[model samples]
Target: MMTNHICFIGGGNMAGSLISGLISNQYPTNKITVTDPDQQKLDQLKRQFSINTEIDNLKAVEASDVIVLAVKPQVLKVVCDNIKTATLKTKPLLISIAAGIRSTDIDRWLGGNNALVRCMPNTPALIQAGATGLFANTSTSDNQKNIADQILSSAGITLWVDNEAQLDAVTAVSGSGPAYFFLFLEAMQAAGKQLGLDESTAAKLAKQTALGAARMALEGDDDPTTLREKVTSKGGTTAAALASFENNNFNDIINQALTAARDRAIELADELGKD
Candidate 1:
């Protein structure tokens, strides 16, 4: 349970999703505080949740026990600087969900004494099925990490990484993984359409097959490779398709794409650290 009042620095979709999930999971909605420059978002949040909402960042910073910086990467430094000025020695455990921003940069931006946790969560979180990867600075306490986990796991699964560098890989994998799956689904639907099926029927078949395959992989005892081999008989359609993929080096293509994404994530972190 979130015993401390958490203040969100932004009231966008991600922030709103976290807040809604937290409230739904038995955390006190009244203990949540939201701050946003946009009045329309603030108004909508206020109407949806019984929590406190404010336009002034300073007041929200002053009142929070745990401050979650839910703003974008571009505005993170500015928001951190404002919170630093407002709170000074009273620095709370700061949790940031901004992609590509390191905890060291967060600490430096806030004058280097604050406890900070940096995390990456995918878009599936909006549907309460997210998987988050968390990493914290040396200043963070065990209890603070637990709190952070609870807040995040309200939407889905949460895992901690020992090496901060692993977050870059995580950003490439699970953080951007959902989009890859979505893209695959789209392509499959298109392929189905090309095979003499109507768009709606093709979509239904594609989606259900994808979902069933995922469930089978997760629930069965066999490994993915083993399970795949079970359905792929010699000279069958599945075997033919698998052969085509192997011939085209699909595995290598996926590896290269993920590596490129990881490199980009690292580059973004470096850029954000440049002051």
Candidate 2:
């Protein structure tokens, strides 16, 4: 049981997932409190997790050792402003999970107090199979960083970035990476359907094949290319597929797509951080 009290500002899906992870992993459910404007959401969280609930955001913050800002990116500044006074008084470790919003911007909105950590976690976090990239502001202490790590690790994997700028790369790779895989899977399913397989059969095959391949990639000592090469024999069906993809410049397209994702992430940061 952790002695720390953690409060989440928004009772959204991501926050609910984290809370669910924490309780299931025995992180002292009584020590957690969630505040949201939606009474239904708050009631659901409280009933599901047997933790505290509040509509008074500042009261929750003042009672907490950590404050997780899990609100939407567009409304984050207003949330920051509303909670600024409580933050200054309590000085809890602040962790923001809103994407594309920088820590400097959060710090500025919070009256220039540091002790901030910004996290970009993908949708897979809702299932506790997430990959998260975290960056801490200069004012955060080592202890607070550890707390952030502990909280997020309950949901999935956590990686720290030395410079916040590299988070844009992280955003492109893992944050947006799931959707890319989903697109590929969707293509495989569609192709299977086109080949006369029933929709259910095609979906099952595509999903399981993807899961198995991902497991192989993770569990095997070989790199992805080596594994791919191992499956791809000369003048075989795999060879035919590879040849087609190569002819279509698949690798170049993937590179270009990820580059575009990174660039767009930067653009979003600029757009959301504007006064």
Candidate 3:
């Protein structure tokens, strides 16, 4: 329902997912444009979403009110440089979804003093079940912030952070959070198989259990701790398993893992933000 002429700089999976989400929400297809180097990808997107597709980034920027920089972090500067003139001329809100690249670096790449929103969206966004963390630079207006939220929320839940530094914590939590769940699922499947279930059965049960647990946590009124306690009775199998996890110092291990992820996120930002 937003009237903004939104343009995406990449036509990859994440971009495609966002386009699909927006269109499904009744966002006007005519107001959307996507630009990418791959003609085949662009053609597929155009056919699938019925939106405008362009190989020329500048032309796309010319008529856009908001530009989603969906390109990879390594080449974001080049993409920004290519469209800087048109972006300055149009003064569109810039939303960068490239990981590790800071807002200051993106602002600088676009010739500075531009409204920019930096987001860290995980791979789950490809399925529209994403959790995205967004941070807006001081140059961004309140209206622009709302627009950015609208666009990103189409994929899944979106949370705003007051400071850009908190995005590193976001990067550690939800950004890398999916992989942690996937890893846990993998372990659960392996343990199930070790307990005599066939591979297919083990995998299916583990996946379905994860899905059910997630739904309960999301939909139920109780918090996760309360739900966990409710399910874990004394002398029960769940309690035994939880005891094993506690004996293994599971909480400390997870804290250490997230800390490492957060530290790496900070390192990546430092590396990517260099001029």
Candidate 4:
């Protein structure tokens, strides 16, 4: 386990998930601290994780080597401002999990020239089954990057992009990816119900099918395309369904949706970065 004194700047669900992942990986409870405005939330985390809890953000920053910015994006600027002085004094590596915020904006907010890693993690992270895309600012060292990777990977798989712009694509793909799958599951469940299955049975079958398909995709040697081809016989039910999807331009629909999502992510960065 890493011995770095890690501090989480929020006590929300994501923060709790990270703390849980760290503890499950045997990271030292004594080396972890969480700071939040809500004493009750802090108290709950303290009881649950046995880690230190503080209401003073600066005090927590001063005591840590790594700071996880797990707060909402709208309040991140204020949180950064609140702890800027202590962050400068301690020079802790900042790992931000806030969505749609840029590294440049965060660096500027924190007095600049700070080592920071900005990552986009999906909601599945709450269950330790997430996919995260990370990008490090130029000031970040290789060791700091590795540390950030270790921290995020505790929740799920981590991938690094060569440039920050790719993070926008990552945001569209994985950050909002869970919702796309959930929507598909919803459609499948509804279709099953239309096919005469009861609501509960349809829901169960759809969810289990999704889980099994995901597991197979993750564990199988064949690529998704190959797997699909193998499962879909020519002129069969699966092929007919796929043909209907093609007829309706499913690939183009997905492309347009992701493009729109990426555009929105870029717009959000611009909107959130403004002083």
Indicate the worst ten consecutive residues by lDDT in candidate 3. 120-129
**Per-residue accuracy of model 1 over 44-162 as CA lDDT, tens digit each:** 99999877899988888888889999999999999988889765767788999988889998888888878888999999899898989999888899999999999998888899999
RMSD values for the candidates in order, in angstroms, are: 1.2, 1.1, 0.9, 0.7
Candidate 1 yields a Cα-based lDDT of: 0.90
Candidate 3 Cα errors over 4 Å, as ranges: none
lDDT of 3 by residue, 245-272 (tens): 9999999999999999999999998998
Q: Write the per-residue lDDT of candidate 2 for residues 1-275, one digit (tens) a residue.
A: 34699999999999998998888788888899999999999988888989999999888988998999999999999989898998888888999999999999999999986699999898888999999999998889988899998888878999999999999999999999999999998999999999999999999999999999999998889999999999999999999999999999999999999999999999999999997
Better of 3 and 4 by TM-score: 4
Whole-model lDDT per candidate: 0.90, 0.92, 0.93, 0.94
Candidate 1 Cα misplacement greater than 4 A, ranges? none
| Residue pairs with backbone atoms closer than 3 Å in model 2 (clashes) | none
Candidate with the larger lDDT of 1 and 2: 2
TM-score versus the correct structure, for each prediction = 0.96, 0.97, 0.98, 0.99
Q: What pairs collide in candidate 4?
A: none
Estimate the lDDT of model 3: 0.93
Clashes of each: 0, 0, 0, 0
Candidate 2 regions with alpha-carbon error over 4 angstroms: none
**Candidate 4: C-alpha RMSD after superposition:** 0.7
- Which stretches of model 4 miss by more than 4 angstroms? none
